[model samples]
Target: MVGQLRTHGELRTDTVTRAFATVPREAFAPGAPLEQVYNRDDVVITKRDENGLAVSSVSAPRIQAIMLEQADIRPGMRVLEIGSGGYNAALIAELVGPEGEVTTVDIDPFVVDRATQYLAEAGYPQVRVLLVDAEGGVPEHAPFDRIIVTAGAWDIPPAWTEQLAEDGVLVVPLRLRGLTRSIALVRERGHLVSCGYELCGFVPIQGAGANAERLVLLQSEDIALRVDGDQIVDADGLRNALTLPRVARQSGVEVGGFEPFDDLDLFLATALDAFGLLVAKPAAIEAGLVERSTRMGAKTALEGGSFAYRASQATSEDRTSFEFVVYGHGPDADRIANEYVELIREWDRLHRHGPGARIEVFPTATPHAEIPDGRLIEKRHTRVLISWPHLTSS
Candidate 1:
């Protein structure tokens, strides 16, 4: 697993590589097969709810490695880890060495009990495993050099900012507009600014800080929109639109067949005034009701009684390239489809090669004048700013 991580460039430093090499992952998951334990890409789920949804898990090795790389944990630095699993705490203990403090907290009592037990058995008894909701942070160990959240967070709570040391960094998987990015944020003046971000996902946070995306169903449970904030979802209007003919438009933008367009997804999430992710079940796609993109949550723009979603068509006979297409439905289909297509072209022209959005979080009381120029998303605890930079040479 260590070799695979290093080969893929996920393990960028010797200390982290050594941590992965030394930690006995099987000690945390006793009955799991060795093959599953050692799989670098797989996550080991530890507990689940009554509905069978995973509530606690040991994250995939690759993900842990990459996030640790972003964290840049140094020896003798205090670290606070939220959403504890025994294995991750062990890996952190290795990075912090014997002198440094590693405190891991979780809301689930079962997770805490086992983590405490496993830490002792694994020779990491010094790692503190606490049964507490991390929404307020561990006050006894304030001013941590680094804070890493292992759950998906919808908003930045003021406590996280207050507990972090002035020069400290916080790495969290933050959900924005239904998209989750592992953002590494640092204190800049009175706000937290993202130094870098990478696409990643985690189980929704549980307890006082939990806020999840709302799914508005268009066709029973099969077709729906993953909505964030106050995006409108006219279910009856959209159900009627899906039955009517779909209005389609082609954008001149093209991407290599093997290229990743996650950046384009981020662009649309910010550039559009109203956006949600269109989700679909296999039955809907098999009936030719929606494009395949909906299976992976397609980028969608919504207006009253109307909506448009992004799709793609192969441009080459061998499928070596693809051109973006937008499909709309309902009363204002043409206008919504045109607006969606124009944004696609705009992203290609200005942001395909330039820096992506610069995201920042500030106190909710921050004056509008103080907030940077960009989309201002109002959250309960903070105001988020997403500003895109200008074009750069390819």
Candidate 2:
């Protein structure tokens, strides 16, 4: 697992690699198979809600390693972990060494109790486990050198910044639009600026900071649009539009089979005026109702009675190369489809291989003139700005 993480560039530093090699992951996930516990990509679900949704779990090792690298933790630095699962806290304890302090907080008492027991049993009794809504952070342990959030956050809470040391780094998997990215941010004046970000997903945080996306169901429980922010969605109109014929347009952009295009998704989420994620089940794709683009939904643009989403089709016999395509439905299908295709072409031309988007977070009360020029996503607590940096030709 350590070698795989190192090879994938997730575990970059020796300190992180040592922590991964030293910690006993199986100790935290008792009763699970050793093979499963050691799997780098699998998450050990420890608790679930009445709805059977995962409420807590030991996060996947890959994500853990990626976030740890992003954190750049050093010995003697005080670290506060937002979500507790014993294993990650133990890893952080190891990274920080005996001179540092590690505190793990969770909203659920059951999680806190289990994590406390596991930490004591796993030889990490020194790590502090607290029961509290992390939205407010652990005020008693303020001025932390590193604040690592282990859950998906919709907005940056003021307490997080207020408690963060002036030179500290806050690593969080922040939700922008409907896409989630684990960003490493540092305090810049009164706001946070990104040092780097990675594509990731986590169970949403529970409690005062919790914010759930509004799901607009189109076809019963099979198809839905996951809308974020204050973007109003017309469910009835979108449902009726989906039944109409789809207008398909192909953008000459071709991507190799193993290539990743998450950056393109981020671009579309920012470039389009109104955006949401188009989620569909396998049944919907197999029934020929929607194209087989993404299992977790495709990036979609919503405009009144019209909607368009990203789709792709194989352009080679070997199926190793595929061209980017857009599918539109509604009264303005042709117009939306053309607009979506043009954005894809624009991304490929200027930003595909260049520096990706620059994301910044400012307080909600910040004036529009004070915010940077870009796509601004307003939340209850903060306004997120995403701008693409210009690249220089070598």
Candidate 3:
């Protein structure tokens, strides 16, 4: 079954494909609605509480595959699955086989109970389900071959690193700026080195290891963007733009098969440059609202206005399109859109499609710091790290 399933999915091997098929997703999702249990789509929200918010869920199959591949798991491996819900642990167990050991942990005791019962009922009782704060990890089962975080973490906690075995791999969804990226970190010579990056979104990692949410306030309009920092610069121009009257708004636009995905860092850097003027000055930050359009486009609303503009173009078009229902002349439309257009073209100058692309996260604390002469990297307030060369390299 796994072999056959592999032919249809993005996975490379029949082994993983089989594991997915054999693991009846329904068993682990006991309380989940039928549609979600059988749906092979994206993540299925399973546990939402009184406040009407999602607290836990079964990750999408595609995401599961991506993480598993990034983990580069091997048979007979000792693995640790954080924020366990039984479904992912069950999949890992199937891949690891009887010879391998899988320790699954969750902060909620009830979640652990459910995972244990589900795994036992499924006849894979060998999988250990522990009720503990996974943020600190299950140190008793230290030195895991691979540690997979099912939730999102704003920063890599030191404890997880300390528990990692030499050469171990840790797959986590790291939140950078406001975007989440799936990161694979390998323990190399006592250091956690980046193995790879993938575009992703996941629930925030809870517990003592959680990071404080960064909040951004848009002065005039109701749009507030929360990243992990207060160092938002150049928002003045945007703030001033907010004083304009609203005339029109477009829903959104679409962009696909673009080079940005190939190199997210370059895409972000270009975005920062193109939008830097707005991000740098106080006027811009207070002026408007910015929201993600399709993977390649963005929707922005002028200040004191409710109208929106969708920026996108045909897949084959040489020049991208900025589609908008202008409000009251949208006097600044051409200048703003042209600024974005120029930034997108700069992708070629930096070669944003591959390797040289890098995304750097800055901590919310101090605005500036000194780097040691011989060190290439400097840790930032446990939540961020900035490379020495990056400051002057640009």
CA RMSD of all predictions: 1.6, 1.1, 7.3
TM-score, one value per model: 0.96, 0.98, 0.72
Worst ten in a row by lDDT for model 1? 229-238
Residues 4-55 of candidate 1 have per-residue lDDT tens digits of 8898888989999999999999999888888888888888888999999999
Q: Whose lDDT is higher: candidate 1's or candidate 2's? A: 2
How far does residue 356 in candidate 3 sit from its true spot (Å)? 6.0
- Point out the worst 10-residue segment of candidate 2 by lDDT: 288-297
Error of 3 at 244 (Å): 2.9
From the highest lDDT down, the ranking of the candidates is 2, 1, 3
Candidate 3, superposed: residue stretches over 4 Å from native:
1-9, 31-35, 215-222, 232-240, 245-266, 269-310, 315-340, 356-394
Q: For model 3, how does the per-residue alpha-carbon lDDT over 329-369 read when each residue is reduced to its tens digit?
A: 13465554444344344443444333532334333343444
TM-score of 3: 0.72
